[model samples]
Target: MMLPTDPAQNLAKLIRCPSVTPAEGGALAVLEDMLKPLGFAVARPTFSEAGTPDIENLYARRAGDGPHLMFAGHTDVVPVGDEAAWKHPPFAAEIANGEMYGRGAVDMKGGIACFVAALARHVEETGGPSGSVSLLITGDEEGPAINGTAKLLQWASARGEAWDACLLGEPTNPERLGDMVKVGRRGSLSATLTVLGRQGHAAYPHLADNPVRGLMTLVDALLDPPFDAGTERFQPTNLEVTSIDVGNPATNVIAARASAAFNVRFNDTWTVESLQAEIHNRLDTASRRRKYRKDRKEPVEFELAWRDNPSHVFLTHDDKLIGTLARSVEAVTGMHPALSTSGGTSDARYIKDYCPVVEFGLVGQTMHMVDERVQLADLETLTQIYRRFIGDWFGSR
Candidate 1:
């Protein structure tokens, strides 16, 4: 049997699968074929919730006598914005100017490919590591996330699965390979605030209360008072107002309600509950301010609704895991990687609850762009880095 030892070949096979969110697109099947030949016992479990699309996840374990290590990632890719805008077909895995162009070339599928190739090379040369290894892959990372890593982790743990450490294959490098390894991540919280008012003609300002004014007051409160000064290990908490809507199309009428949605990438200075309380406090105080509505005696009539689950902040303290991966990157790329906690939330937020997790993968410069591509040289370098980390992590354990 031939092993999947070539990173480029493994990546090409995966990119050919158009596994957009909520769609399998044969990506997991391709992965299964690669793992089966390497002595793994693979399980494809589908999870579902009432409002979420059913998700297919893969858990392939190659059991050994030592501590278990997990490689977590998603096979799904974001939709190609404009297929015609790409230099090469998004799913064709065309090679041009020493880079491979495809939808998932860097955001994630490329990371999985490099890791698989690294493991395959390890198996062929050293009969694999002395410890256990597994891949926890999900098809719903780019979707609603209801049936993805969080549920998959719970399901795996229910069946007596555990890990000493995890290396999430997310694109962590900002500029070049080995430039960064994410050791922690800030929390994520999202909510929508709506202000209620009476609708009337815009010219008759005294006859109606403009909810847009109240919404602007609340939004200003959320934006000001900067959540916190920069923390020692993390950046300052920042909130972004994503959308403000009134649902009113008329130009000469005041809308009955105005709502604004915002998301916060917060540091460890606050928990989800505390943050919620703070926001409520801000809105409460701002609602009573007469600056926006001097005509009204009562506070601004408003409601706050939180969206989905809030991702809590986390930082890994496992020295061995961090040191081993850092050394591996430096050894391969000759540049000491920075242990960072910047960037958006990922599945690592869920995995951290189970075991200490760190993220490292290809450079992420071109992820989610029209012509998403990865330098061919990066595939080889990342494979070597992952291979070295695997051997060192298991050997140290």
Candidate 2:
């Protein structure tokens, strides 16, 4: 059987699957079929938790007796919000004016497709690599991220699977295909701070203490001082107040409570524990200071709750992985890709615990946005880069 050589074709097949988050939607099945012909043993394992959806994950490996390298990504794409807003049908994979438009064209189905194409070309020309190659794909990356890469990694490890290094095919480039490569990612933590107060008629000015005033003070405390000056590899830690809500619509009534939700994308200088302590310290100090009305001076009666799981900050410095990928990008694009840690968290945050990981793929300017698309040239360019990196990495190993 002739293996598909064009990454665009591979991507087209994937884009047509409509595998929106947590849905198998035939995305992984198409991949399994494609890899099976290339001597890969593919497994589709569905994992379940009480509250989350049953997630289907794909683990495909072609065996060899040398150093092992893994490519990690997700098959699921984000929802096509307001289908009418798209220029083309979101799942149609229509190509026009040298670009293909679809929901996962870049944010990552394109990366997976190009990797497969590159591997196929490598196998056809040189008869596979000196080392083994495996793909750790999950259908949960765009969802709660619960039973996805985290569990897939554990499941694979339990079965005696090991990897020397892993590269995530996430959209790391900001503008052009080879403009950037993510060497690391900042950690993310979210909190909801709810402050309590006595609710009463607004006309009765002295009857109730307003919680909004207190919540504002606490927020100021959190943002006034910069978290830290940042580290050499990471940007300064930033805390954004995503939302502030008292949920009171009445003009005359003072809401009994006010809640503000904030998220912090921190750097290596702070761990989750230390950051939590720092937040507590700031809130405590702000609430204790008699900055509010003197008569209502009481420690900000607030409840703080941490949100979903936090992603830990990590940087990969392995010469074999980072060095090889850098060379590959420079060779293909004629520009040295900037090694950056400037982006939202990804599943790479989870994989970092098991193996050294880096991220490189198509441009991300269109990811998760309406009219998501990728240039046709980029698909082939990325494929060649992956092909070269594979040969060089294993050749050296």
Candidate 3:
């Protein structure tokens, strides 16, 4: 079979793999074959942890002597919910009405396919970049992220590998190919707050302290005065209560406990320790306030537990990487993509510690949907953008 040159074809081949989260599912196998022909040294490392499933990741590099550039992405995708709901089989790679439909079509096997195609095109036209180019592709991005880019970067850096800049091909475009590029991401902090109280009869006036009332008081304080006004580069810090529960089944019973879980997506104005300090301060002050029972003056007993590792807010300021990608996008699509720091966290969070990193990729309107798909036209357009970026980036060096 002739080697496919178009990103759409490459995307089709990738979509044919069933590489759902935490599963290799032959996706990396397909990539290994493609990169080998381009003279890339590909390494597949399977990383494992006690609780998390072992993840197979690919790190491919074509050696050169100038500034090293790395492209980061994940081959693993979220589960295709209700496969029968799709217009075509989720893994069939069916092309219909000018769209290739399948799981990972846009979030983001599509991005990976485009980058590889662009690399191939770059080599054919200019005989490779002046500097080394590498890919930190992971299969655990959609899972717990235990054995993925975080460890991979550590592994690579330990071996004296350093990157001048990194680009994450997460689906950044909200609507169209040249619409947006992510320069930074907000930090995320999740926590569960539980308030303890004594169970009592509902009819009693001064019998038990209701932790539900205390929880409401705290939640109010957390959300009332906004964390901060919108910053120049990021939105205002926002906290949301995800769950509030009292386990008591009977409505007449005053529950012994009430718990609430909340998450805060914050900007650079605060660090994890500072933000957490603010939360504790709020809880401490609120817990001491008067209860609804009026006579009971004892403070609310509460416990707070953090969930998952909090991601630190990060911004990329590399002129070469940002300028090259921005210029390339304009040249390819006649639109200057907006430089944004407005999105949920991505693997770039991990890559940021290693090097300056940015994110740009396919339009993501259909990601994680029933018929996740990518437009054939957008695939080539993004490929051309990446190809231009490669030429301009390496040429500038």
lDDT of 3 by residue, 133-196 (tens): 9999999988899899999998888888899898899999988899999999999999999999
lDDT of each: 0.94, 0.92, 0.90
Alpha-carbon shift of residue 45 in model 1 (angstroms): 0.5
Candidate 2 to truth, TM: 0.98
Error of 3 at 68 (Å): 0.6
lDDT of 1 at 348: 94
Model 2 lDDT at residue 103: 92
- TM-score for every candidate vs. truth? 0.98, 0.98, 0.97
Model 1 misplaced stretches (Cα beyond 4 Å): none
lDDT of 1 by residue, 1-397 (tens): 8999999999999999999999999999999999999999999999989977898999999999999999999998899998988889999999999999999999899999999999999999899998899999999998888898999999999999999999999999998898999999999999999999999999998999999999988899999999899698899999999999999989999999999999999999999999999999999999999887888888899999999789999999999999999999998889999999999999999999999999999999899899999999999999999999998998831
Residues 230-316, candidate 2: write the lDDT tens digits.
999999999999999999989999999999999999999999989999999999889986666566756878889998788889999
Score candidate 1 by lDDT: 0.94
Candidate 1, backbone clash total = 0
